[model samples]
Target: MIPARSGNIISTGSVCSYIGGGETHAYTCSKHAIVGLTKYAAVELGQFRIRVNCLSPYLLATPLANNFARLDHDGLENLANLNSNLKHVTLKAEDVANAALYLESDEGRHVSGHNLLIDGGFSIVYPSTCFSTQNKIENE
Candidate 1:
């Protein structure tokens, strides 16, 4: 609260901020906007002892995501596994929540203007073009 003069603001976003192409341009732009807002708010609110951060998670098998992708739970998980660089671990909703908890708690006191990714190294390692190119190469 403003009365407290200290607070934390956490926002959600997609991994599209780092790498986009599988979806529409507008969707990617909005995710990038969230990142920008986090940074801007961090600078603007730092004096008030308010921290602003964003948690960008990759595809998780949620109702909204499932509806958008038109895939079942197993299919969505399979797709995420195939596209992600870290294949051993699957991304769960709780994982994203844990990231939020960290930011909200004292553990992340010094963390601000950060876009903490909950992706399984997907944005860093998986190239947007690699999927299409790899399939083409295999076919050839």
Candidate 2:
């Protein structure tokens, strides 16, 4: 990359990077660190035309998530969708892959130190308050 004077460094993160979820403290902290590293690296490497970014996706039905939630793929998907802000849509690995591809491609040439969230607006919605407010309005 140094020789080419251009490159992209994409790091994986989680929704925990922006908001605390059910994940362990260590897991959340590590995700936060990845975001920080992405920013710092982007600044340092910008002179070399190297871009650094992070992909922070919401919960997925991976083996790790399944183990943590003690639920199978279907069960986990159901749980995640229940709290998701987007209705009737589930996040898939392909979605994340597409985001990565965009970052690596020319379309994202000017994007750096960006924490691209692949969440279906999950991070922006606080489930407790959001659902409680909606329920109150519906009940009224």
Q: Return the top candidate by lDDT.
A: 2
- Candidate 1 on 11-92: residue-level lDDT in tens? 9988877676635678878989999999999999998899999999988999888887779998888889888889879999
Among all windows of 10 consecutive residues in model 2, the one with the lowest summed lDDT is: 127-136
Cand. 2 Cα-lDDT: 0.85
Q: Which regions of candidate 2 are displaced past 4 Å? A: 127-140
Tens-digit lDDT track of model 2 for 32-140: 9999999999999999999999999888889988997679999988887887889899988899999999999999999999999887888787534322333555677
Residue runs of model 1 more than 4 Å from their true location after superposition: 129-140
